[model samples]
Structures are given as C-alpha cells and as structure tokens.
Target: MRGLSLKMLKKITNPVLLRSDLLMVVLNRDSHWILVVLDLKAKQICIFDSIKNPAHKDVVFKLVEVLYQESESFQSFAISEWPVIYVELLPRQSSSSDCGVFVMKYMERLLDISDGEWSWRQYLNWQVEMNVFRAQIAYDIIKFGEQFAKEPAKDTKFCNI
Candidate 1:
C-alpha cells in the first residue's frame, strides 16, 4: 500500500491518521448506533451494528472518499478497492434504547484486545445486562472525575462564558 504514486499523496492534511493503525468511528443513523472501523494495517473497513443495515456501508464508503479528497495522506489509498466487511455475528442489543451502550461496549472491547487476538465471535460472549452496563459506565465516569479532581491544577486559566 505504500509508494503507490505521487499524485495520490497530494491532499494529506492530517499526519496523525496516516500513522494510526486503526481508526474507529461511531455513527448514528436514525437514532441507532453503528461502528465503523478502518484498519489500515489490514487494509479493510469493518462495519459493526447491533441491527444489521446494508445502507450504512455506503455511508462509510462515502466518508472514506471524502477523507481521501480532503486529506493528502489518505489520497494514496483507494478505499473503493479495499474490502468492506459487515460483521454480522456480534452480540446485539435486546432493546433499541441500548444501542449507545452497545456501541460504547464494542469500542471498549475492541481496544482491550490485542491486534493479533481479535475475534468477533469471542468478543462479547458474556451476558451483558444493559442496566448493569449502564451503571458500570456511570461508576467509571464518577471514578474518573474523582481522580481528576484530586490532581492539582496545571497552567490554570479561566474564561468567561
């Protein structure tokens, strides 16, 4: 995928993305959450949704095209040629209201696993009660806040709203 052509490298605006191995984006379509993961090393774009939707793949392709056009670093890559995979066998949300929680958990699990150890089938096998997951998320947030509050202010600056 490297040293393809000079013409393809003209529009790169973000160097950070070029260096990243994985890019994960969460999308909301009609209030339903969807996860799009761009695996640069694997040369594939994977879409994970609680409820399968084929139309979302097109949206991700369009987004990649826009990124290629706007960013010089992405111009060398051809997203149209790369395979787009729709992960079908994932742990689904039992209720529509849990889509956000599902997406968050998906991201958390993905990040927790090592690159070589990723397996969609084994990802979320454990039973996840939405209510329990929500409480855990809340607890994590509160714990983070408490730890952050304990740290002394550094280079403090105040601005009027």
Candidate 2:
C-alpha cells in the first residue's frame, strides 16, 4: 500500500505539490471519514474533525509511523518536530452521517481558499451548507465523468490492485 501510494503521488507534475506544502488526506476512522491536513509550511498536522472529538496526538503518531515506513520517497517527512493541532472549532456536522461529505467540503474549501487569500480566522466561520454544496459536487463530478469519458486514462498504473 505504501509503495502504491508513493508511486501514485509520483505522477504529479506540479512542482508545488511535489514539494507538498499541504498534504490533505481523508481518513476513515471506524466508518467515519475525517480530514487530516499536514501543513508542511507551518510544520503542523491539522485535523478537522466534524465531530470535534479527535485523538490528535494518537493520529499524529500513527501518521508519523506510516510516513516513516514510507520514507523512501518522503525523505523529509519527519513528524516529531511538528505539532498536532486538532481544529475542533471549525465547521461541524449536525448529524452522524455527514462526516464524509464534511471532509470533502472541508478539503474543497481549503484548496479553493488557499489559491487566493487564506486566513484561519476567516475560515473558522466558513459554514458547510450541505444542501447546496452536495448538489454542486455531484453535478461537478458528473460533468467531470463526461469529460473523462472522452479521453482514455493514461498508463499510470504501477501495481495491479
């Protein structure tokens, strides 16, 4: 899995992403999906948990362990020096089922906002209006699928799953 992940990441041609200023991962914790944002710029591991009950330290340790095991490509990946900040005060899901959607929205908003002006203070109040955002994402995915159907996916596979 580690080698497959590294091989997949190597396909990225973007210089900024190769440097990986911010690495966002959606993790499945007991059927619940949560967002883990590694802010390499600040050297902080930020967890945006929709339930606001994240084991920040344990998650950080686990992340470091995974990175260490996968350290061949991630030569500079050292998490001990970085602090794990559980961002519980960010947008929260009203119910138990919206965690996956919340993670996607959180990543989308963060990437969109980061491209222009980004301030943690301003983003704290950034609400996840699920009704509209979910529909928008679905439509976008459908459009993307249509465009993707027009072209074939390149030979990007390294290992057969």
Candidate 3:
C-alpha cells in the first residue's frame, strides 16, 4: 500500500468501518485535531479530514513529536499540507494497544504543563527536531483579548495578534 498519492488520501474520511484492528491517532492543527486511521492488517495509513476542539497546542505538538520520534519508519511518512498528519499500520508484530500508549503519552505531557513550572524554556530544541514552529506564542499572548477594530484609521494595517 505504499506509493499512495496525496490525492487518494483526500477522500478517505469515512468512519473507517472495516477493521476492529484499527489504531486511531488524533493530532492537532493549532486548534483542531485530525484523526488518522491505521489499518493494522494492510500496513497502510489513512488520514481523516476532521476538525475538533481547540485546546493547548504545545501539549498536542509534544505528543506528535514523541510518537514520530519513536516510530522506526516515521521519517518516510508524507505530509505536504500545513496541517497534514501521518498514519500507518501498527507494525505487523506489534499489539494495537500501543496506539493507546501513544495517545496516553500526550495526555501525560499536557498534565505536566499545568504543573506551573513558571519557567518558559524555548521549545526550540524539540520544535526544531520535530519541525514545528511556535512563532505565534508571543503574538498570541500579547493580542489575546482585544476587540477587533472594525475600521482602523487609513494607512494603518491592524494586526490582532
């Protein structure tokens, strides 16, 4: 099932009715989550086009990084679009339970963030390795609550964030 085109994947958001041996992975896109289906028997990956609740991006990003980092063939997965996600069969000999383990890792990471370290380390090292950028944090914080001005005075391009 390799060499599948990006075009073919775009139409696969169906409820994944075929297999009980499936592994579902939901990763974030700044705000919403995309569900990825792994067909354990076929060794193929299917990403669903779905959007979900907005929560903490940092924690979600961390989860994705750790999962990809540990997967042996992870580097070969294709992700061209800004919010594209990767899915693949749970390696043939492995148990589908590992998928739950992978998701739990993210939940643990989120709990850690809420502990209030009060120290913000540049997420750069992990970000660089995982290829994700947190460039919007400073802006997101600074402009988080102001009302959108309907009409800014001429000659001024107002940026909310």
Candidate 4:
C-alpha cells in the first residue's frame, strides 16, 4: 500500500503531518520492527534494517511510493522522484529480537549527529551500549518532558517525579 490511508491521517488528532524535516517511520512486518526515514530536505529515503536481506528492498520501495503519495496529498509536495537509499551498513543485531531497539537507537543516533558528521561506522557497538542509553533516556524524560521543554507554563501540568 502506498503511503498511509487518508483515513489514518484523519484519525490522528491534531495531526503533525508535513513539517519541513525528516520523517521517521517504524513499522512492524511479521512482528519485526524496522526503521525508514524520509529526508525531504535531502530528497532521499533511508532505510535502516538491522537484519540485512534482499527482501527489504521491496519494503523500501513500497515505503518510498507511499511517502511520495502522502507528501503530495498532505502538503502539496511531490517527492516521487526522491531516491531511496538502502542503508545496509548499519549495526546488525546479534539476536533475533533486537530489531525494535535497533531501530530506535538508529533514530536516536541519526538525530543526534550534526550536519557533516553522519557516519554509520560511528554508531557501532550500539547493541552493547543500549542499556546505558535506555536508562539515560528514561532519566531525561523524567526530568523534562518532550524535547526537554524547560519550565512548564502556567496552567500546564507536569508529573512530579
């Protein structure tokens, strides 16, 4: 199926659809989660699969088609010509069940890197470092909500932690 159904967008309350930035998607195929990022600014779609396989090319293409359609429909932007780059050089999971975690970590590191600092090699050993990063994320969230928004505004409530 190409892009998400229009009904899907309607069901999403206060839909944050088309910001001028990379859009990340995490999808489950047969209970295995994988990551796909649409870089609108770069005109590229990057797929990060922890388990490398030829079948993932089909998944990537489908996602590209879907995103291209959705982008036009949602924001009047056409991304049909954007190239899809299969990132097969990511840190492969040693276990069968770490796909979701791998996707999340991939996203985290991707977002953390600055312009001109991106390299798949730098993110190696992520599986081994996952526990520490997980705890750190938990701590950061408990300290500050949603991108570390400091000082809740008057009439806004925050959970006491």
Candidate 5:
C-alpha cells in the first residue's frame, strides 16, 4: 500500500455490473476491476445515471447484459433476503416483461433520495461525506476560476488562436 496506514475496502463477492456503455466501478482497496466488452476503448470509474434507468443506457448501449444466479440459485429466495442476491441489470429501463435485476451480496445499499430519515448505515455515511464535500467544492471553484481570470492589458496585442 505504498506506505500503508491501515487502509480499507475489499471483499468483492463476484463481479460484473454493466450498462452505461459499460463502466461503473466502486470496488476499493487500492482498486483494480476493469471489464469492457465490445470496445469503447477503456478507462474506468464512469457513472452516468441520467436520472433514470441509468437513463435507458443513453438509448440502448448495445442490448445490455447482466443476470446471474445459480449459486444454489439463492435457496429459492426470501430467506430474509439473506446474503441478498437476486441479479438484474439487464434489458435496460428494466422490466417490461419484468426481470427485476439484482446482484447483491454484501451490499452498501443505494437508491437514495435525500435519505428521508437516514438509516441505511446512516444513508451510507451521508453518501460518502457528500461526495467528498462536492469534490472539494468543485476543486475550489476550478481553483478560483483559474486564479481569477481577467488578464489582457499588459500592452494588449496577444493573438494566437
């Protein structure tokens, strides 16, 4: 860990959660979990949930795929949603004919809407500290708008575009 200090995050119970043109990662512990099929080049940590159905995959990102079960097929469900895993993330905008996708195991519950009364681990610790305090106030407003952009008089005449 480059200089460890008791870091956290680990224990991925089976992976794969595509759609959004594939790229949605959040497995920590000095991370590494890339999976891109049908090439869109490849980088990572891309999450664009356009207000819904991962916003219908920005209009069908190639017929999506995600539906796994079979590990004892979850003992026919309802065991208090035990070690929960029902699998679903398929066929976009979900369920016209219904498949209610799920792939939970040790979930960190999602689907939050301003956490009505907070309790899913205190709404996941205020959604991870309000997304690291809104990404440090959007990097201090883009470093104070590039150190206060307003320069053009040192003798003018500076064109190069």
Candidate 6:
C-alpha cells in the first residue's frame, strides 16, 4: 500500500499544497476503505476508519513523509510530525462490505459540518441506515449519468450514430 501511495503521488499532475483547508484521501487496504483527512490549517491528520485500527496511524505517517518531500508548501512546517488522530468514536460498520460506503458518508458528513465541529453522535446509527444510503448513492450516480448523456456532442461530424 505504501508503494502504491508513493506511485500515486508521483503521478499527480496537481500538487496538493495549499489547495484547500482540508485534503481528503480514501485509501483501500486489503479490500477495506479508510478515509484520511489532512487538515492543513490545523497541521494534523485525521483517520476515519470503520473498523478503528491503530495500525493505520503508521501508514499515514509514511504517506505524510512522502507528501512533505514532494511539496514545497510543507517545507516550512513539520507536516510529517503532525499529530495522527484515529477517530475511534465515529460510526462503525457491522458488515465488511460497508467500509466503502462508510468512507463516502464520512466525507459527505465532513463537508456538511460547519466550522470544523464534528458530531459523531449523529452518525451512530449509520449501520442500520446503510441500505438507504446505498440506494441514494446509486440513484445519484444514474441521475448524473442521465444528465451528462443529455448534453449535445461537441463534434457531431465525427459520428452520426
């Protein structure tokens, strides 16, 4: 996973330095998804895993090192030394297949939160609501695809069909 992350970093055309107050990364390890958020303003990394594993902290530390080396914006601050917070109190998934959904919901909730204040209690019952969330996601994707398909082709001369 570490090697894959470094390769991904090398392939990025746009560096993530100072682009936003928060940087969100979804990492897949052994079929499980984990959400990692780099809070630039707070100088810390927050890990949101449905399973709540302590090992993720070490993995994030290595990734942060690569990020620090690759970007000039991190040169002034010790980003690698930033605190790695494992958000254990957030919602947990009872089933293994829901990790990806949990990660997506985590991102959505994070974006919806105002003033950096996170309320984990609101998502405590997410396990029961997984099916509803899954349906909503699928509906949104199909709706987006339908909307995109409605747009006229830019080069209509290429193919009539």
Q: Evaluated with lDDT, which candidate comes out highest?
A: 6
| CA RMSD of all predictions | 7.4, 3.8, 17.8, 5.9, 18.5, 5.7
lDDT of each: 0.73, 0.69, 0.36, 0.68, 0.26, 0.80
The weakest ten consecutive residues by lDDT in model 2 span: 117-126
Task: Determine the backbone clash count of candidate 2.
Answer: 0
RMSD score of candidate 1 (Å): 7.4
Decide which is better by TM-score, 5 or 6.
Answer: 6
Q: Write the per-residue lDDT of candidate 2 for residues 1-161, one digit (tens) a residue.
A: 35666655554344554577788877776787878887877778888888887564565567666764555444455565677788855777777788887888788778877454444555554345677777888999999899879985677454443
Q: How accurate is candidate 3 locally (lDDT)?
A: 0.36
Report the candidate with higher TM-score, 1 versus 5. 1
Supply candidate 5's per-residue lDDT for 6: 12
Per-model TM-score versus the true fold: 0.76, 0.75, 0.24, 0.69, 0.22, 0.80
Per-candidate clashes, comma-separated? 5, 0, 0, 1, 4, 0
Where does model 4 exceed 4 Å of error?
1-19, 69-71, 74-76, 137-161
Which tens-of-lDDT digit does each residue in 1-161 have in candidate 6?
A: 45655555554333545467788988877788999998878988999999888887776776677777875556555677888899878999988799999999999999998877888897797999999999999999998899879985577642331
Arrange candidates, best TM-score first: 6, 1, 2, 4, 3, 5
Candidate 6 — number of clashing residue pairs? 0
Clashing pairs in 1: 11-71, 11-72, 12-71, 12-72, 12-73
Off by over 4 Å in 6: 1-16, 151-161
Query: Cα lDDT for residue 4, model 4?
Result: 40
The all-Cα superposition gives candidate 3 an RMSD in Å to the true structure of: 17.8
- For model 1, what is the alpha-carbon lDDT of residue 155? 54
lDDT of 3 at 126: 32
Supply the TM-score for candidate 5.
Answer: 0.22
